[model samples]
Target: MIKITGEHHFAIDRTLFVFALDSEAGKVFNEKNKLVTGIGKVNAAMELTQEIQRNRPELIVNLGSAGSRSFGKGEVVCCTKFIQRDMDVRGLGFEKYETPLSGIPPVLEYGLLKEGLPQGICGTGDSFEMNHAETDYNIVDMEAYPLALIAMKKNIPFLCLKYISDDAGSEAAEDWAVQVHLASEAFNKILF
Candidate 1:
């Protein structure tokens, strides 16, 4: 009973426990069929919790693609902690996109680079980054934040499996499309 949620559907390598998201990127599926109305990352956690409350799963895995601020492509970094890098609250002079809490969760861990693949901490954002000049985070992506926040609210044990598709401050911008397949393939090899 593994359900997956992310922005893209075709990028995942294996489909054994997959629950494919639709165009708006939301759905519920068993091993046999799917049921999708209209949902996205913001509501995904509650949706999954409700679904799992009715029938609990062993665990939930949040799998997707991301942009790296400094790391190179083909790297498979796991997020020990993910901050909403786009959360704007600087009017009071507080740091924008600061971590919600002080310390990392004990359960929020990973076996990074276990397969001899490059891996590192993932810093999530709500935009596509083409360079790492201003941002000091390791990776950037849109959906991982909401997914992590929601999952935390539900007290669900989860893992973020991301592949670096774009390097924020390099020529990798043009190479993103060409490297996506390689990244996905790398993620598949490491995750499964």
Candidate 2:
């Protein structure tokens, strides 16, 4: 029993999962409940708010691709924090990522997931690039951040399951898509 809407609408079954995006892709994972929109983070929050204003779920699981600085091929990571790495305020001699608002709970320090979980920093940016490397970062993406911010704002449980699609190197651009697919499969194993 898989329920899907847009990339966001999901239902709980034996294994609840969601693969949301600003655009439509693949076969209808679940057609009756799917939603399609280009509106992001803020708009997604509003949509989710209105939806939940009607019915709230227990948890939200986000699955997506991300660039990696330290993670190896086909690695899965549970984010402790989401960073907006592109928010550069260097022009003003300051540094910040312009986080939306915080309300989400902190990651469980020691839980069932900690036995062999990969620990790393997940950062967000509009573009996927290897040249823009940060020594402290391990992963990069465009969506998880706003999801984290919105989840924080709504005080909801959020888990980001990401697959490492690229390395912080020149070849990453051409290799990302294939790597993303490989990583997604690996992520499912770790998560399930």
Candidate 3:
């Protein structure tokens, strides 16, 4: 067993695993792993940064459930790109997802390729998505953008795998609750 001594006291190795908001999404890994959960973008960024600083993990893998209109429920997809859908600065002449003062681009891209996982673009916001026609992204989540951004800034390898739990429709929450367990199981299989 790997011994981890830090502020978090995690037993995980050099790789830090992360989840978001819901507990069901992390059910499998939470038993033996010290996984971080960010309820939203701000919380995610802060929590992930603190974990990275404390543990100095070489890589960070964020696994969670997501809503998608294109992907079928229970399908897991690796997010190659992340965008903040709630960061709207159109009045200041910046694009919808662009952060004005930040040097980072509106869309942060992860080039890592994982075998057997389909590639997708994840658009993240604070609110749960109920309409699929509002955005063009392949998946919708609440925390992936900040997690990806923090990982990029800290120069750590970041990989995001999201399980489709809903269709971003009126029944998304209900669907998500039912599919989260399956997502967690799928994530565990991929990681271990």
Candidate 4:
């Protein structure tokens, strides 16, 4: 178990783990951290909500593999901002990535950064990105936005660390399969 003391010297008691796949979760699996994994955005959101309601951990950490056009494979990054890339409502007069009628801002910020890890904005969606989008986001994942949004809504501290598994190219799936263990190992280094 990792113990992180806050500004007030209060140690975080528990941290919830949210991952999109078993391969990613297996790499960082431990008996101490409570883990919940699902395939896509909806499943991840639902599972995370349920987990938070049931466990109510002091912090929520979403760790997993991501495809990045800006970073090299196996590079780990800490995400301080999250945006939903598939939420396009431009025709309805809202911004392309805006969440319609949601009082919360479309962009969610999780402001925790480790000293040596690169910081980035994670773009989340249901589909795996094969072509790069014309956005400023540096990393792409399937579940970070929903996980971050739920953590924000629940008033829980959120942190996301992503390992670049692929470049969002045609080989993304295969690359992710092979590189997930590496990401997990890297995450282990950060946690301990």
Task: Report how far off residue 39 is in candidate 4 (Å).
Answer: 1.1
After best superposition, candidate 4 residue 106: deviation in angstroms? 3.2
Each prediction's RMSD to truth? 7.7, 6.6, 5.3, 2.2
Q: 1-192 in candidate 2: lDDT tens per residue?
A: 222222433244322234445222233235333333233344444555565455554555556666676777667776757666766555664445542333222221111122366766677666657685575467776666666665556666666667666775787877675665465446435443
lDDT of 4 by residue, 24-49 (tens): 86644655465656778989988888
Q: Please give the range of 10 consecutive residues that has the lowest summed lDDT in model 3.
A: 1-10
User: Which of candidates 2 and 3 is the stronger one according to TM-score?
Assistant: 3
Highest lDDT, which number? 4
Which lDDT tens digits does candidate 1 get at residues 17-97?
212133211222232222231234445545555655665434445555567766666667666456565555567555666
lDDT of 1 at 7: 27
User: Which residue runs does candidate 4 get wrong by more than 4 Å?
Assistant: 1-13
Whole-model lDDT, model 1: 0.49
- Which candidate, 3 or 4, would have the higher lDDT against the true structure? 4
Q: What global local distance difference test value does model 4 have?
A: 0.79
Give the candidates in order of lDDT, highest first: 4, 3, 2, 1
**Strongest candidate by TM-score:** 4
Give all TM-scores, in the order shown.
Answer: 0.61, 0.67, 0.88, 0.90
Model 1 ranges with Cα > 4 A deviation: 1-56, 98-119, 134-136, 170-173
In candidate 1, where is summed lDDT lowest over 10 consecutive residues?
11-20
Q: Tell me the number of clashing residue pairs for each predicted model.
A: 4, 8, 0, 0
Encode model 3's per-residue lDDT on 1-192: one tens digit a residue: 222212222234666778875464555665543565657888888888787777787667788889998899988898879888888999999887899989777888863556677888999999988877755478999899988887887887777889899999999989988888787788777656
